[model samples]
Target: MTETILLTGAAGLIGRVVHHMLCERGDRVIAIDRIGGENITACDLTEVHRLYELAATVTAVVHCGAISGPMVARDNPFLIVSSNVVGTANVLELARVRKMRRVVCCSSVSAYGNTPAGLDLVPEDVPLRPTSVYGASKAAGEHLLDGYAFQHGIDGVSIRPAWVYGPGRTTECGIRTMILDAQAGRTTHFPFGCDFYRQYVHVDDVATALVLALDMEKLPRRSYTITGGSYITLAEVAQTVKRVLPQADITMGAGPDPIDDVQARFDISAAERDLGYRPYVTLEDGVCSYADWLAAQR
Candidate 1:
């Protein structure tokens, strides 16, 4: 059956992939973004009236829109709050008014902030202690959705993706930068030390998780941690790059991890059981595929 889907942030990395997947699967996508694109309707999500108008025709909403990135949130806290928190409220209100079937919110694992040592893998039940403003905004968004769901009986699910990377990535991530630099035969140096670790999920897998959540008949869990196969350290990432491209040069600074002490690993059993979410891309294969894509762009 054909469904009209409202896709916010349609031009963003994950949103773009999800839009493509939806279109390919014969679904109608009402793509909206703050920035104008070929087929994307330019509109700010904070405008509640405009969202209500857009939501009336769509059966579901895949909200991938927000002021993302840690640095942006740190520098401009107000924009982060308004765009993430206020904008999310607008989306949920639209859903409530329209009585939409389900809404799949693209959340982040950063919500589980500053985990203590020896507690490596985080789960959905972990308390949301956001260390950064961006994480807090995401946590707030999740809370807002839950509130709406409880009060208005909205069927909403939030998918928390960790360190997403792939083609069309707008922001700067260590792995993406290293892979592109290696493809260009340029030396790459990272400020963070080798101790730094993250659970990196490919953009395609994240998009798939969102679609799965959207298509499911019933959602038992409100939020699921969707990540890569496992957590990997920066040193392991460099090794993978070197293994793929022997001539590539990559180095990391020597010191303790300067970043916040958050759990880099996540137990995604909830996602697997509820949504059949399984990350098929391994680090080696994903890097190689990304490198190939970078080479083609040159």
Candidate 2:
């Protein structure tokens, strides 16, 4: 069934991937963004009336527009809250009024905030103790959805994704930067300890999860955490980079884990069982594929 999908942040990495994926599969995508690519409805989502107008007539919405990145989030705490929280509120409001069947929200693992020292993994029901304004904003948005779902009986799904990387992704993320730095023979700093467990899901996989949730017959509790298949330490991530580019120089730096959870692992059992969410590509496979592309860039 081909349905009209409203994709926010269509110019960003996630938005671009999801938009293109949908387009290729013969799904109708109404791209919305402030910049990047053409055929976009350029307007700030903070404006309620403007946002509602843009959201009108769409069957489903993939809400990916927000202030992402830990360092960037730290730089502008207030802006993060305003853009992510206030803007998300507007999206939810419009989705309700438009009577859209599904609104897929892009949440982050950062909503968990800094992980405690001993805890190994985190689950969805875990209390949100966000350290950054970005995380707090996402938590607030989640609460809004929870309330709206009960009140309006509108269906929604919030995907809390972890460490998404692939082609067209930003270099700030762990694995991609390491590969770039290694190839340039630049010393890359690995903050947040060597033992800090990390998960890297490809952007395509994340996009697949979003589409599945939107089209699924049933959803689980309006929220699900979509993580990559494997969890490895930062050291392992760095090692993989080294294998790809032996000349790449990298170093360790002091950076604290922003989230309170010990290991950033999401139990995908719910998503798998409910939405048939399976991440076919592993980090190694993704890195290798990405490295091949990176090699071509040089």
Candidate 3:
């Protein structure tokens, strides 16, 4: 099915990938980026009225614009709340007023913070326990989206993708940094996430989830969690890098990553059954892809 969609965060990693996917699949994309990029409109989503204008022309939205990650703007909780929370409200409102078809909100696994260690695959229904302000913002965004879908009678869904990593990544990713270190012939002294079981899905896999949510015949839930399908540690990630770059010398401390302590494994069966979602990028392949991409950039 073809859709005239408004895609926010058009310049970021997942946005860059999803924009191409939308256009390739014969959908009309009114792409906008807060930072401004080629063929992308520069606009801040927090400016509520600005996006409402697109509501008339677009059938649905792929809302990816936000504070992005908990690591970013760590010192500014207000920015996290405003951009992640208020920005979501604006998008939900636009969808509500226009009675748009659907809204695929780009949420985060950060929302499921403070999970019990080694807990069985965490499901979407788990009560959110956000530890940081950024995490709380994402959880709040999900609630806003869900409420809009129910009370306001608009179709909305949130994707809590695990630590997304791929090309055009503008944030600090441990995997990316380790690969970059290998490319630059530098020793890697990573601080954390060496033993912690965490998931890292590639940007391509995440873009697929966004598209599935946008084009699905029917959605049965308000949220979905996606991952690389394994609890991989930074130490394990380092080993994967060395598998590709044999000479890569990497060392990591033995502690939970300071950025987060959410160590619960995730069950993606809901996404698999509903969205027909299955990850295409394996951990080793993702490491190879990122390493090769980094090499070409230099």
Candidate 4:
């Protein structure tokens, strides 16, 4: 049966990938974003009437729209509150009123805030202690979904992803910047040293997890962590870039890893068990693919 899915943030990094995957699988996708695109309907999520209208026909929703990233939230706190918080409420409310089958919200690992130093393998049961406005907003969104699921009988799950990277990534991350610089044959000097570790999941893997959550007949857990199996340092990422593009010039500043103490590798066993999520793209393979894509674009 063809199911109609209302996908918010249809033009976003993750949204675009999910949209393509859903369409390829023969699902009817109703793509919407604040910014209009060729096939995406333009609408602000906070507009409750519009959301309710859109939800009337869709069987499920994959809510990926938000004011993402810490810096964006830090700079525009008001926008974050209105969009991420209020917008999330609107989405859940639509689910409740429309009797939608399911909703899969895209969350972030930043919701864990500053984890205790050396606290490896952070689990889903860990208490959320958000360190930034963006993290706080995502935490709030998760809580709202949980409440809706329990009280209003809405079926939903929130996926907390870490440092998602892939071909279409335009964000200013160390790995992405290095790949672009290498592709352009420019010497890249990153400020962070080699020991800085961060967990990354391929954008496609994250998309797969979202689809899995949507397809599950029943969800055992309301939330799950999805990340690359292990942590890789910035130095390692740069090395992968150089290996992919031999003779590429890249250097890093000398300093201790500033974020090492705060970051924790996620234990994705719950996602594996519940959603059948397994990250297939290794860091080396993902970087090499990204570098190749970059080269083709130039």
Cα lDDT tens digits, model 4, 1-298, are: 6799999999988999999999998999999999969789998997778877776788899999998667554667989989998999998888888899999999999889877666667888888999778888999999999999989999989999998888877756677778777667789986767667778888889999999999999989999999978677778877777888886788887664553236667889999998899999998888887777667778
The stretch of ten residues in a row with the least summed lDDT in candidate 3 is: 47-56
- Backbone clashes, candidate 3: 0
lDDT of 2 by residue, 241-274 (tens): 6776787676765444554345556677888888
Error of 3 at 184 (Å): 1.0
Q: Give the TM-score of each candidate.
A: 0.94, 0.91, 0.97, 0.94
CA deviation > 4 Å runs, candidate 1: 254-261, 296-298
Mind sharing the TM-score for model 3?
0.97
- Taken over the whole model, the C-alpha lDDT of each candidate is 0.85, 0.79, 0.87, 0.85
lDDT of 3: 0.87
lDDT of 1 by residue, 6-52 (tens): 99989998999999999999999999999959789988998777877
Please identify model 3 stretches exceeding 4 Å from their true place: none
Q: Write the per-residue lDDT of candidate 3 for residues 1-298, one digit (tens) a residue.
A: 6879999988888999999999998999989878989978888987667787655689899999988898899999898888889988988888888888999999998998877666687889888988899899999999998888779898989999999997778588888888888788899997766787678999999999999999897899989999988787778888888998888899887888877755678999999999999999998898888877888888
lDDT of 2: 0.79
TM-score of 1: 0.94
- Looking at model 3, residue 153 earns an lDDT score of 91
Model 4 scores a C-alpha lDDT of 0.85
